[model samples]
Target: MAMRASMHLVKSRTLLACAKEESEYRVRHPENSSPNARVLVLGGTGRVGGSTAIALSNLRPDLRIIVAGRNREKGASMVATLGGNSQFAEVDIENVKSLEAALKDVDLVVHAAGPFQQAERCTVLEAAIQTKTAYVDVCDDTTYSWRAKSFKDRAVAANIPAITTGGIYPGVSNVMAAELVRASRSESNGEPERLRFYYYTAGTGGAGPTILATSFLLLGEDVAAYNKGEMIKLKPYSGMLNIDFGKGIGKRDVYLLNLPEVRSVHEVLGIPTVSARFGTAPFFWNWGMEAMTSLLPAEFLRDRSKVQELVQLFDPVVRAVDRIAGERVSMRVDLECSDGRNAVGIFSHRRLSVCVGNATAAFALAVLEGSTQPGVWFPEEPEGIAIEAREVLLKRAAQGTINFVMNRPPWMVESDPKELGLGIYV
Candidate 1:
């Protein structure tokens, strides 16, 4: 009885401390407390966008949500799922007038319309800047993300903040890397040497055709990775490594891809060697993806229209497989220091569809709360982007994660951690 009482007291104190911290955060950023903020989620008809809308509605029931897309039926369906505080907007991303009209009244816009690869213009972002509305995007393409960053000056001039690559893998993953690097430096762990990102997801990740198009597009690009302060390009999907993603997801084979977070992390976090790789389940899918790289011409793969056709052809099959494969997703970030010290961060969730929405909504909430400065920023940028609100952002993003750990030794988070005699694990 006495021990139980003591444990309850400890738990109460911990909750009090957390409440105090949250109070301080709210005091520091008053904009987040706005009661009547309106948010527009472009591409809300799609899987990623619809999920994001649901997540935002769940997180802040009072906020008004507008589901914007070209398909009125789909948009209306999504809005209906979001309850009374939500409505549908018929807007096409390619139509500047449509985008501008949609942005006029929204406090923030989430550009979840993607297959950002090979996109030549930042239409929605430009519209956001023109309307002086804050923005966030779930962009996974390297070229598009950098192009968004090029608008830093303009965004600052417009006095609106923007974040690119703010989705699950690139978004939350980038923040995770930053936190790991920050801890290493602050703790004098060692000079951070190598940073590797490994990701595993089940078939289609329950994200639908958009993700399929993105994958096909990525196959056309060469993989860019940093090695000892030098950049090198390798064939996409060539390098494969077996990574353990802890419980609920055992070891899986991941492959190299031209993901944006690698460059952003290497540059923003100043890591010497950085690379990102991803793989999906139902083993045949991995075989098929590698086969596509070899079978299809690079030009064919790079063509957006061609990729869409391919997505159309494969969508049914992928969706069928997704049912059996499930939508589990896991990301493991490993950082090795010069002095043989290693730190790791892992995020695993049962449903990629749900977790991605939460991850994106976390970034959206951060921007609404005044956590970002008036400029286009990457997730890893420390000054005024995500550093200040990282803890809260991570907490929100990790809401449904089955396994989430940070700043721990590799062994602690590994599925099959090796014991190296005595009490040491490696």
Candidate 2:
């Protein structure tokens, strides 16, 4: 259902509020656009998709971008906004023929259009499979991500490379944890062990509804974590955590939740233990848990009238809230070796777009550059994939350097175990 106009106006102001609190953009590296690699971004007119397109255009001038979406005008507008070497085509994601036609001769496909809850029954994934084309998506939907994983066996057989979870929370969060595992294993003389992953968002406003939807779908679902070398459930919100987000985000409370990364971090990376949590600016973070806890049980959350009513009410209020505060998103991953040694790493980014866009674009660039395989892969560990992958993303998000921490906390030069574990839970 279309959002009420009042809701839209409120959303707009809320976004403005988020922008004000966003950190300054770090200086970007010049695009390494190679003329040989061409990319087709489905849903390129949307938020994550659009940001991914812009980041890619800016990062790789040699890349020719073909944008396909339902609306030609909007697609063309996005293309125009992107400047040279970009074009748009109207295609229905639901139609197999339309999708196949768009996929013909495309080097890589970035599926950015979603709320895949509705789109999954369509032809997007199947078209990529049939075309034998590489695919990537900024999908935040957990069910879709799991279902996409089912494509791994077939994709490998077809020699088609595909990647999902190409957005901030799952995309970078997955890779960042993978990198920590790889780094820790290497440091520990080749032995990998337990893993813990933390995810937090402070200035992330545009994605509030998306995050809320994700939480609802996973609620009451058994969240799996490794226990003593065995898989186990960690009830969502069962483990309250207090995570220190450094100066930009400050100290905030988080909850133990069954999250997407738990699946990949353990199954793909072979880490014995893996957990993920949500982090936001203090108030937004707290409000999310409370609001989701309340709204998820009823059909009202899906009700257009109720959604708009709340959006209209919260939108204006969110603006005033932003003026009083700021925004941020940070992630931390720690690896524990069976031998008792440990290594910790943290990545923090201010703008939601940069954090996810840089990661998605870099993965696309890797495919274009032939640094990644044609088969499906989760960035479980940095060692197996292109060595250039992390560097490419880190370089693009150069304006905001991703902080890497070891034994010390990024927010504090020293460590306090209680501060780290206490605040985020309750």
Candidate 3:
């Protein structure tokens, strides 16, 4: 099939990009030097999880990979694709006993089992603490991420290391925001006043049912944003802004979403104002989301079982749109300073599946390289992945990226903005 060929091409190119940096990566993160590291990828049967497993296997051939999930056949299938260095584990994340036993041998656990919205507890995190294993998760839910953060002392007490929201948007995007802030301050002594995250994905970026569930669940929660050093709440999908996402993926309209990175970045990076917005392609999809959020009762949308039915209803349609959209994904992080200047970071990829894998694998490598300490933390913590480690992580995460740039002025990336006389544009 043409689609299959296209995917093969992208993946092959992605491997080459990652391979180009392999030597430098090994040198910089020598903790991955040994042959003893083991990784268990929960939800390994699914899209994001499975892709991360493949990326990790490619990045660190020395580490043993475990493709874990509730389905035996799917896990086995994923492990087979990972070739000789991988095995399969049928483990239920919600079942602590099974999870604890699985963690008995895993040096690290990449918790990709997500759409972490509407979740009641951080059960997998608790199990990892019990087993004393180093961990990372691709959680994007604000409430869930904070819940995971609540276990900071427990993780430290158990001498375990953990990272939450270590996937694409909240994961790599978090670091991008941090890097922009650091660069602005260092370059021009600009005090970071406002930070905004804008993301655009064409038709779910090939993400599946779990992500759909996550989206539906998120519509029920009140949106959170920091405005001029104050916390404020707004209706989901209310604040709309037309953002330019740089070349390869130009301008698109985005609306406010209650993403985890909004609060975490505001708190972690010390920015006075922070918010995140996301938009999808074929424009009508945005309208549908607005309609759904408006028409559906918050309580009904909050129910997990009900959300699952809605996911089932929409998955096929999303998949069709995804096939047509070709999985392009882009994220732009912008920083506004008190000194009246703006800087931005842009990341655009042709395939979200490929990029998501690489982004998450970068985080996993950080934990494996001992970049994170024995405590629960977000990806940007200096004690976690650290600022110096960021460049290396970005290098790995940006492999096969169609476009990647950071710490540039607004005029450089924007297609068009108002221009004033004598180059003194505001």
Best by lDDT: 1
Candidates 1 and 2: which is better by lDDT? 1
lDDT of 2 by residue, 227-340 (tens): 545776555554656766554554566666666677777887787656666655545546675566555654554344455565555665555664454445677666667776
Q: What TM-score quantifies how close candidate 1 is to the native fold?
A: 0.90
Question: What's model 2's TM-score?
Answer: 0.78
Off by over 4 Å in 1: 1-24, 27-32, 415-426
Candidate 3 residue lDDT tens string, 219-243:
8988888877778887888677778
Off by over 4 Å in 2: 1-34, 117-122, 189-191, 207-212, 215-222, 282-285, 298-327, 381-384, 387-389, 397-399, 402-426
Per-model TM-score, in order, reads 0.90, 0.78, 0.90
Location of the lowest summed lDDT over 10 successive residues in candidate 2: 20-29
Per-candidate Cα lDDT values, in order, are: 0.84, 0.61, 0.82
Weakest 10 consecutive residues, lDDT, candidate 3?
7-16
Backbone atom clashes (below 3 Å) for every candidate: 0, 22, 0
In the order shown, what is each candidate's alpha-carbon RMSD? 9.2, 10.9, 8.3
